[model samples]
Target: MTAADGVAATVDLNGNFPASPPGSRSKKMVRDGPQPPADPTAVGVKKSGVLWADLDPCDEGRAPTVNGGHADTASGANGANGANGANGANGHHAGHDDGAPDGVPAASDRIDGVLEMLETHPESRVLVLYTGGTIGMVRDQSGALAPLRNRLASRLRSSPTFHDQEYAKRRFGDSDTGPLILPVSSEGRRVLYTIREYDPLLDSSCMGIEDWVRIATDIKAHYEQYDGFLVLHGTDTLAYTSSALSFMLENLGKSVIVTGSQIPLWELRSDGRDNLLVSLLLAGCYVIPEVTVMFGARLLRGNRTVKVSADSLRAFDSPNFPPLATIGINIDVDYRLLHRPKATEPFKVHCKMGSNVGVLRIFPNIPTTAIQSFLAPPLKGAVLQTYGAGNIPGNRVDLLEALREAADRGVILVNCTQCTHGRVAEVYAMGKVLWDIGVVAGADMTPEAALSKLSYVLSKDEWDLATKKEMLRCSLRGELTAPARVLADWDDLDAVVRALGAKPSQTASLLVPAVTCAAAARRGAGPLQAVIDAGADPAAATMEGRTPLHVAAYEGNLEAVRLLLRHGAGVHAKDRFGRTPLVDAVQMDRHEVIAALRGSGAHLGAANPALGDKLCSVAAVGDVQRLESYRLAGTDLCQRDTCGRTPLHVAAQMGRSAAALFLVSSGVDVAAKDLSGLTPAELASAAGHHALANALRSRRSNFCT
Candidate 1:
């Protein structure tokens, strides 16, 4: 059997046919000379001439036949059989050849079959760009495996496991095209995809900035034609390509999935089939918007991924981030984790990627000369993989001097963590040394992300060094975690809060103290202590006589309340309405705040004539312990407030699940009508708490029981 026949026979085809001599294999033609770099700024080994292959007609027109049906007279006959198919004797049966040449199938019959497969209108369309990878690798005459353009699409077309014939015919009626439509039924939605193999397929190791730019440009060229895109790339530098693409494509509103496999698709137990199938499904059905890597049943942010294994099928991981979606019996996407595109923003490609970046992994007893040489001229930026939390050797003054010299020469250095997880924190003494010397903290950015981001940042020639440095620290396309803001002083804190557009306090005289105290309370002990030490009164009261302790308790700031109590703040201090800190805590349903206050000797205020108000406050806080205490103290749970709202009404309106459940369990009236003549369920529904509304409805039946 010819090699092509050998390769084709390994696939599980659905129909049966008499085997014939294999057709001619497409010649792998190498392009003439090295192609000029696509991006002017791209600096790397120039790619060789494009590998060219004739388009395989089988991919676009092959049709599945039933039983021992006659082969399409238009298409060529089946290639010679090799060993039995992977599915044993039931292995894909080939159609019987008509009155055609020994190895050639009739073209007219093939066209008729193709037309039949084109019956169904696609629900969704994905453009798969097969750049080149192990997924398409085939053994050459020398028996060495190498990527053969058009081979991947051919294998997928011939495989019944991938292109289910019976499922397609049942779902989609006879059409103009053969069963060429690849369908992925996910979440009850079917996705149809087409593959466009790149001419001169690339080995990912040879991929550079220009290739990334080319891919981005291709997507831009076809952005409006398809719903999403899938890139078949080599695994070696797949992460780098994905990372680069993440930066290159800005405001991408559709999924761009990069996937590959360790084993070739022709292998009996290859991962390529699943990877390709999943990538196609994700690209066609999901709106991930960002470039992502879908592999081993996990969809990760493209820029966040790193190839962690060379031999395992689960070869990639996002060390510092979680997978955006996990594939199981169902595709479970974390919608909250997805980055939604702004409606006002249009998708655009930023193809100008700078390639003059390098990575320097520091090691024990590493020499200063090596660092200087690596950071020499032409290298615009470098990712410095440092020790834990971005620390370097403190004793290595020479190495520090080398880094300082590089920084002085305008070489931007990004300090990234050597560890897979955690971030580069400037806590260690050596870490501070790097920070002081102008190294931009890479935060939790993966090495792939850092390197690509640096290249992207440096490509912006119009921006000043300071701006580039700032952008490096900032998260442009969800590549890195932005560092937490550390307020320098109270003024800085106030400025930030004001920027949030909070309304100013109404009482001018008490406004400053009240706002300051409230802000401190929200920030917990650190800022609260700073404010107190800065001469702000711990006992300072608002116009409503609400002190810092009351605000702290209402915010559930246990540490802030403790700090206030330790600073001689009054435990029984009452607000303008005669509400103590404990009352405020109860009103907010802050159990921890109440526990802290109760531990500090704070007591529930004396029984007021407004006993209904106290009960509602207790219910609003959802503190069952506090509610029990009030019940034991003879406060009626069924008491109605001035508005005739019961504790249950308040709990429902607040959407306090815990309190509502507690009230229901205590047999409080679930049918109790509020001031508005609405039951707890109605009140919850009106408040847009559907889950709580349902719960209340369920409990109402229990109450009847």
Candidate 2:
């Protein structure tokens, strides 16, 4: 905040992130029978090891979310959204029981759902979770389950259907499964596409925590290198996987979308094509920063999403949270629901999660271990999910000790309210107790923020107890609001007006006024001839700061200054800031004005609050030629300002090139320094004027230097 140091703007990641393939591919054939398509509404269902369901309603041509109402479905021949999963080195699973219900669905029904999603959310990252679905499965020699003969990359390459308007054609190329990976650019941001078949021998049904961990790791590693992420996850446990990842990542500034389809791609009429396409579009260009799950056309927060129906395509719903965005015919992003990164510092990958961290959901009568386990030594942090405004069930001694001990040990204990509208700090005394004991308050911060904050803190190299406590008290983002109050006034109008009106002694016409006043007092004819020529009463002069004579005096007008003094104008009259005419003249370094005042016998050195070092700088830089007239008037040459910078110091440091030669020739010290410890020579050198510097360095005339 200081003048020397300003705030740093956050960095933007533009050149980084992955890109898609370019060009077309030749047709490739696969000898495989398509499996029955699963009902989109089925829950916990996996068809050919793939899950496809309509998670939420969508807006026109956009993904559906909690905030947006239903978007009209689109009708057309749809193109894949061009979203590709990371390289899946582990191959696709084969012969797995496709999680579809017993009925065969027309391929057109599935495609219709996907087309609607693609049209609704045109700009998104669509991850096609190819978990050996109907299209991927083919019979091996042993009649066992295995991926079809053709690779997904080769399939994408054969078709030029995937393309975004902003991408350069050269930036994309053919893929292994025949589906071209198209890299799109928007407003300088980029996203890359590649099928998940990089894992040449794995399947989604066989996916475990390690697989999820790997997927999350890949996303995190590339996050700084990219703006968003899209994951191809099996729909069987898609919600669980999404929720797990939502809780895992920290300070996620990009989007993480998990999506898969119900039917296989090679079917006469398949839903997988549109679903994969829509998911890809949603993941690639949407700018909301958070974790999301895309099924059919709808996108939901990974953690908040729940699979509601077993067969119908629209499947996921965010019960307690609003959808960050909706894509049906058009993408409508709700900025409010999305979590944005504030620092833009850089995306950091925190692969390690303190699995030991516990969450205690407070109910009316929870047992002691619920609180006790949180304070245990092994625990790094705890999310004390409390009622509205962080109210505890009861202030038990055990609970208090658990909370206090956790905080004292540098374990960040966060208080997140059960209610949604307000934060914990505003309503409860219990919240204050936690704060007093060093427990951090999570005011209005979503569970996401609390979890993310805790992970961010614990992952640091230095987990200092004091630092953690301080970090919690301060805001990382402008999320918290402070109370407002009134401030006191410090007006200086009177002072400024007085300064404006004051005049220096050099302009004061006092002598002539004194003569007239003397003549008047003696009852003389007031010099009838003198009075006539005088034109007006010289004694009728201004003593306040605004006299016409005072104006001339301060301006170094020696002729006018002397005329006023001679007219008997008072010299001791003080301006509003208590400055006399002599003080004003001396402050301005107006030697002629100073000389004129002294000629009239005015006080030379008196108390004056208005005179300062800055005024001396003005004096040093002002008209130095006025100094010659002062000498003729027999004025003192040894006078100094508050900083002990005499008129000579002013003449040497700030004196003009011509005036400087005159002053030094007249015996002024050119090397003289003020209280700032800067000599005239040093000042010239600092200013980078080489000639002036050389002049100051010459020892022959120390006066000029």
Candidate 3:
């Protein structure tokens, strides 16, 4: 596909492209309420659009046509900076400001005040390129007829609406050489034309192989004639034209503004006036050095804009990019986004385009007819929007046949994912289908990127299939994310931990697959380690019901519990759900880990505040050595476990005399009270433990000292 091929298909008609939807409202005025703080670097005022001119002035008034004014004359007496020779200190005569530069007004700037500032000049040639639109239309006895340029100029000069605009004041000056109006007519009502006073329709879109050749020849033909060039175009395929021009216009130093209005100038609330004013400002200025788009108060690189919305006044938005300049309460220019001119003076233009483009979107249950249609097309290039990680459903012969046919026909198919985030790759068995069928992976490019890349690829006449394939595999403009999912074998749990480490929010950011990957990797030392590594505190407990220690104990992972403890996992931590590790273990009946936890000084009863009696019962019924270990490890001997029996009371009640003796020897007073206020000995006596009662008496006598 070559630039020539794309241009060869162009139909001759009104050159302007699609206008914005009707009845579209402008963005609500910023001045309706309290004003925002002013910024000096603002790009455009609301009404004036923008004023971008190079700082230098020409002594001979022979400025560069693209960046400088269209004529040798000055803009106005205080409207525009004058030629260097005219600079004398006569109170803003050319370079000085003794008083208000222009006599229009002294108030602060407004959204609609962009054109009013030009009244300061007397000698200015404001050529009006009147592409037959409502602005140049007047109703005669016959009907609506295109008015003459001079008449249009007079109407503009007298209208208060024009007075409110800054460009009108600067260009007309309320004096001589009011405002020049030149009318241009095209074929249809749908497609209007915008032309300068001279030769028109030399836009990149209008350039064919022959047109490109001629445009290149024309620049050489009129090398020293014009000041600058401004192109008016439709938005639909503007990027393709811009990209073509950027490639063709090599080492170019002048500015070219490509813009068209959403609403026709004939409409009462049209955007044409603003778009026109700004385009001229850009052309007459000396600052802009590359191909640009001036529309709806924003100036963007011609290649960056995409028509994101169909009907809104803001029809175009550069989603994956920043704007070059924005016109609003004030014009704001992002100097960084602008390209500096090349040192070389002259530039050559190459006008060529390659065709053979195709695009495909894969979805669930995609029909055979749809698949066959794309494969059968006259396509040189294609982009396929695929499923997760570039996967396709099971081998439907039709899907395979369509893809195979396209590849067989020498058409390039590039795979891009439908997912907004993450890359496409061979994650599942189905993903290998596109890879096997010679479909190049796009990694993670937006649809706009896919289209732009396809256009660029097809534009180069000499590039081969192999070269095109390689280009798709590579990243352009930082659009794709490649070599995706390095931790394919990771476990979900581990992924959750890593996600916690990097993003501490409770809501999961990485998807289910990522979670599975994290879990498969490693148990990750311990919950504490995972938590701490994920930027969470080792001491943090679950908001719901369990600390990591509680979970570990409940799961019978004694080692995990120990690791948590060693790393400062709070053993005494209670969950918001009010369960502790020991309590959880007991509830789950994980006796071994529970016994181990008890040995390690875990307070099982404390977690529940009601498990005292149960702990005592378990101690008596279980191994005596483990019981003693629990006691030595700081279990409360006098406190009742869940069953409401203190250790001594349990021992006496069960007639475990040796256990009773150990409790007495371990300094558990038999006189300790239960809920009934009955001492252990009294409860024992009531149940007939006379020996335990005598022992309690002896203990009381010994403690009397």
Candidate 4:
């Protein structure tokens, strides 16, 4: 399998692996906590009442008024970048050190000591889609706050913090239609962006499956036009929209950040300006490569996030997931938390998001009729936000039967916890009862994510009830955490195997998945032998879909491969990427392992065609993590795309200078020409990426014969 397919985080070496981004997650962090993403925002206030309007997460929000003649000099903080603000009507907060070493070179420079990152790429074109939120709100004649439509750009231009008039005039002289240029960040790259406003605008509470589809389609329509996207949404259901988009935008390889504010931009005090500026910077300067939420100083995974506070500025948090990147003196991205997909196809927008879904928050003495009615016809799926650890009132036989009937009728019910942290598992008898009745465990997924995911999963018309139920358990996006069956009870593999005794086959079946995971941690012949002697299955794979044999080849453990081969491990068995153990060895340049695999009857043509296609896409998207994996896997960097253009050609044509530079360093054919008889540099020039074209041409002589 190729790097694009299901791969583990075991081979982390300077961002050369998918399991972790370089320096984002140190091995120490990987072993300690739940690995990463998700984000949050303000809800108007603490929702209190006897009951919700409906059992579903409804879009009924207090309609905001429009600011027809709002002034530009509104209130907000001078942002963390120290670029756009003078001071807010409320106050200002100082920027803190991101803890990155001070002498670290600017993002545009040839970074020393560490491997090249996509951040080194210059000049990002971004699309700032204003879908209406508190960010653009202003006081109306009635002294009420309302989202202004079609006038966000005008408001942004009024403030020097939001728009740098001097930089724009200097950079785009004589061109009145030049893209707005954000003040260069400390990382040293400018975000050239265009603002697209929704006609009437929307409060996120009004967002649904159709709205999610619209946003996803917009991104797809202009997918190649911009480097990334920043979505401004209302806080009430921002997390829900984020979750919906993550699922809808399948196979995504670019950043999509959703952010808004607790207060309006034109208010005497607001956090809107700071939120907007940071979202712009992140959308352009860095390659986060997942749907994220940026608020306060945290960059989170969109789906995993929940709106924690009603009026507080730091409104969102992902209790089950950690922040992907923290905004401070510098953005500290936990590279390992970034979502790298196994899908090799082009980025697609799943527009068919099913809307016949709702949420049912279970409580004490809830009626059976209500449960039956909620799961009635026309309602295909639902999120059951049950008691802690996914328990329901076990004594209520009527409630149990109602759920069973729903399951029999093909209605999908996912059991998510009402508690803030932890996932739903069948540890308790009550929980097990739900599982027996076909309630899918919603492991650590927020209520918003659970509902949104239910909509997406049920919309898959081709998938049957069984497949949909299984998929609900699987992590399609970073919406839910992967359930890892780890053996945390034992400190080491050998000790555990020893404790199980010499003939442990009967118990080994239960320990097989854990054994495969232990194999990745201890990549040696001694440990493999100890575990094998204890009768752990050799074909078993970890939660990441990597077999023990794959780990041996990845780690270049020749002896480990030999021992596994002797035990009849599949040398040609494919992983998620259609990759064999031999291909893993081939990519790692482990000649000794290569020889051993061939000796064990591995085919010469084991390299994946899917790998090449994914590699080309990664380069175009400037995904340094996946690209680094391709390089380490010894993937042919000279491979061509559908247009007969190499990855270098694609990167250059797409203005992905950083990706192109990475291709050059990885020994791609820089002098090669495409179908148009255009060199990589020529393609860059043809596509108007002048600086990138010039850079490629300058480096071409180094590879000349």
Clashes of each: 27, 124, 75, 13
Error of 3 at 459 (Å): 4.3
Error of 1 at 237 (Å): 0.2
Candidate with the larger TM-score of 1 and 3: 1
Q: What local distance difference test score does each model get?
A: 0.64, 0.45, 0.46, 0.64
Model 4 C-alpha lDDT per residue in residues 363-472, reported as the tens digit of each score: 89898889888999999998999999999998999989999999888889999999999989889999999999889999889998888889888889899889999999
Give the Å shift of residue 634 in candidate 4.
Answer: 24
lDDT of 2 by residue, 1-705 (tens): 110011111111132211111111111111011211121111110001111121111000111111012110010001011111111112121222333356733333333343332222222223333434334554579966466544665665454445432222212111122223444333122223545553543565676556657777777544422324566555566665665576456445456777655555545455656666655655655444466877666677675565666565665665555566676667666543444333312244455555556666778767778677646878888777888788775557677776787777777788877765567773567767767777677766555445555655565657576687566555443233333222122133334434656433312233334443333323223342254244443223333323333444555566555444544344433332223455456544566666666555444221111112222222344444444433333333333333344444444433345555555555656666544455555544443444755775673444322
TM-score of 4: 0.55
Number of the predicted model whose TM-score against the real structure is largest: 4
Off by over 4 Å in 3: 1-194, 197-228, 235-240, 243-252, 339-346, 368-373, 376-378, 385-401, 416-437, 440-456, 470-705
List the candidate 2 regions with Cα displacement exceeding 4 Å.
1-192, 198-213, 220-228, 234-255, 260-275, 286-291, 295-322, 334-340, 344-347, 418-426, 429-437, 443-449, 469-705
> Residue 626: error of model 2 in Å?
56
What TM-score against the true fold does each predicted structure earn? 0.51, 0.39, 0.40, 0.55
Candidate 1 residue 222 C-alpha distance from true site, Å = 0.5
TM-score order of candidates, top first: 4, 1, 3, 2
Q: How far in Å is the alpha carbon of 6 misplaced in model 1?
A: 49
**Candidate 1 lDDT over residue span 1-705, tens digit each:** 211111111111233221211231221211111111121111110011111111111111112221134311111121122111222223343333334466543432332332223222223456788899887898889988898765765567566655655544433333323323454364333455567788899888888888888899999886744557899999999999999999888656568999999998788898988888888778766556689998999999999999999999999999988899999998877543555332223467888888789999999999888988999999889999999999999989999999999999999999999998899998899999998999999999999999999999999889999999999998877788643323223443554456556523322223446655666467668888876666555666664556788778767788887787666565545443334576566655577766666655454422221344445544555657766655433345666543355667767765778888877776678887743356777766755678998988876533321
Model 1: residues >4 Å from true position, as ranges?
1-122, 141-143, 164-179, 341-343, 482-705
